[model samples]
Target: MSDFIAEQDRVLLERHGLASYEALWALTLEAVDEPNTERGGWSSVYRLDLGEQAFYLKRQSNHLTRNVLRPFGEPTFAREFRNIQRFKRLGIPSLEAAFFAKRRINTERQAVLVTRALDGWSDLQGLLESWPRLPGVERGEIVTACGKLMRNLHAAGQLHGCFYPKHVFLQRSSGGYAARLIDLEKTRPLLLGERDRLKDLDPFLRRTCAWSDDEVRHFLTAYLPIGTDIERWRLRLDARRRSKEFAVGAC
Candidate 1:
């Protein structure tokens, strides 16, 4: 397939022998300890190794009919590339795109996006799974940091549509803990309303992190101002939790 490489990445692209989209998909990829492979009927992802470094590569294809409702075509790779730029511009820690390409043949469209690997990072899910092993004071500090990060993201008028535990990556820096959100294909502009902000927090609390009511209240205190209507936020979170419990029981 045809391709395009940024001028700055020309040498790296050439060195990796990734000149075309076809070549990139054909290259051998190494499996990490994590479940790095994500597969679906129309898309797939792989963690690729280039010498000692690694990259995250995602490939997607769709029929022209699926592109009818999309304005700039269904090139999700490009969408992710732009979203990563948005996160960085907003001063939110995130990944970097190393390469992107879109190709069309007749009525079919295909795209690929490669991102520089996050080497020394771990998903919040893994950390939370080992939560009991961590010191209580350290855990409280992490939750507070997460709350501040969420507050900053919402204040910037952006929403991470799928804010699940697995999508949040954490790393320990000299200063403290650094957190970043990933899988930004569904990210969109946030409206100027608490409803919009709550939408992000609800699923994150219900489906992702397993924080209790008291913990949620504590987090919101750091997420919002001291005298904010925290009671209202707690009510909303409780409703979300009950609804999730009901849905699971019904199934």
Candidate 2:
């Protein structure tokens, strides 16, 4: 369409031997200017203004780290793809991810993951950094949303390996409150009948004893409820714990 988008398409095709996200990438760059003011972490966040579709584009920088990996630092990009697809299937209220791109320049090959981007959404970590004490309806909404998110993830056979490590942020949405799972790069879906499914809790439960009883209670409260299907969660959580214990004793 535009010269910029067209040029990007060409570069992507030539560099990565793939041309999936060229237009999307161009759209992000075109909508952003030095004056727009961008906010992000180490990853390059492209500020976009698509009228009613305004967003802040996210992509993994070729050189970036800090709890963010290309999913176990694996080149497949399958983890990221599966998460988006699974969330969409579970009807989870999350930022929509679009196509991703793979590109290379010279001897270095790089991957570019693209998503619809978020404009108003804030991660739980950021929100809690401001409001630690969630009061009244906010607290209930947080509990509900947290439980729902976790349920959806587990239903999709995914284990979110980290939850702020005992104390993380909680996001307060306009209509309700929610908790954002930090370090999503550690996510892995339990493959059906796969033995590795039992190993999924290794990362999350490794420091279980580090969690204070109160902290653990708070998390369980947020994650378990009759309406949210407490029985299912308990079964899975206990199964995970038992698997870890057995693995340790076997060695």
Candidate 3:
């Protein structure tokens, strides 16, 4: 078998040092790969199919300015696998995680967390982009679901560093809508505080509320029941505005 997991059959993978569950799959690193998306996302994301199951393969983001050398080697996917495990333990709704060796994708010889793809999920971003609009009831329900999940994640001591609509996978169901967190890299637990909570909202405000600020406020207020201490959530909104300022300065 080749070094990649491109075939449909169960390939034999050396379990020598695999961390993530997907990495446990037999791999044959064939060059066949699918384009991830049209919108400019992280440069490293790729889509790979192993016949029965599909997987998303991506490289660590090089966007950070400092800490030039990434924490994990380009050779191993252990770091990401550990993070996914953290989420799984917290009971955050997410896909199953796995680890896979990727020598060709990144020179450092690192592993990539292989998450089981949602059987039928269309990213909220794409859904919205294609539809152009959603009904008040539908939109409210959607936002409410997102808000509840975020609250649950926060209470679980986990934060999705990038809590945007795109990162969220939505699938219509008999009840309402089911959501899942795709990436597990930046998510981490934090004490209830200003900076940490603010950091958590930064992504949501930018991605989830890409439209009316008022609607965004309503969405958050509904999901997170911060009864008397509205100040805490207010500060979170402010931090998002501040993050925008830095971007302006850079430009």
Candidate 4:
């Protein structure tokens, strides 16, 4: 069993009597979403409001995943905690963990993860649903920002495995708009080659069906290098979409 708490958040968590694993384990709060039950266990997230500050507390019991490195299985939140730190070190914008702990009590493995909230950020899916109501310039700015974010993440040799619109978040920053990612449970180091880019971007393109060809071109212009063939990428992604559709239909 082990525990960690960010120094910056110590005072706040301590003040709320939640600085220890026992405190957090026994703490009761309203769940933000339905509990996820899988892998012979369950996990849930709760919104914790400490005065004016808000934090997300995730709790899980025996929820495990088996990978090549840990065939015996390990807590999923433990992997997510490590990935959060990796994103911070890579200078990628993502969730910030405030507290993390994992314990083994007899046959049950339990874990807790807490993160600071992105107060003013909005998910891309929500924004896209209202794209038509948004001004043309605002839409362009957001798309361009999101494109740059994707480019930077790929350049850093990272992959946001689940790069859906809901996982990508945007906020109006002092320098126009800034993009951040959430739901890093599936995120990992990117493999070499252009196929890696397609792996992440394909789902994004498929999900954002509201985007016109022109808007997609604008996004590619921002993501690809100058003089790069944007149309080629468009064609490749279109092929991938078709392949995925066929696979789904055949099932």
Q: Which is the leading candidate under lDDT?
A: 4
Estimate TM-scores for all models.
Answer: 0.81, 0.52, 0.66, 0.95
- The sequence of per-residue lDDT tens digits that candidate 2 reaches over residues 9-124 is 34433443334555544543633434311212123456644435443544443432233553334323334545655666766555454445555456433445545445445654
lDDT of 3 by residue, 1-251 (tens): 11333232234123233333344433335433543333232224455665566665454322221124654333224445556667778787876653343333352233344556676987877765643367666665666677777777777877677776677787777787777777665666677555675666665656553445566666678666667465567775775677665532121
Best model per TM-score:
4
RMSD of model 4 against the true structure? 2.2
What residue pairs clash in candidate 4, if any at all?
A: none
For 1-251, candidate 4 gives per-residue lDDT tens digits of 36899998999999888999989989988899889996789999999988888899999999998899999999999999998998999998888999999999999999999999888899999998898999998889889988998998888899888888888889986678899888888887898567889988888877777788899898899889899999899898888877764432121
- Residue 43, model 1: lDDT of 62
Candidate 2 CA-lDDT value: 0.46
Local distance difference test, candidate 1: 0.72
> What lDDT tens digits, residue by residue, belong to model 1 across residues 154-212?
88889888777788777776666777788888788897577788778877776544566
Q: Local error of candidate 3 at 76, Å?
A: 6.9
In order of TM-score, best first, we have 4, 1, 3, 2
lDDT scores of the candidates, listed in order: 0.72, 0.46, 0.56, 0.88
Instruction: List candidate 3 stretches off by more than 4 Å.
Output: 1-46, 50-52, 57-76, 99-108, 130-132, 210-214, 229-232, 239-251
Better of 3 and 4 by TM-score: 4
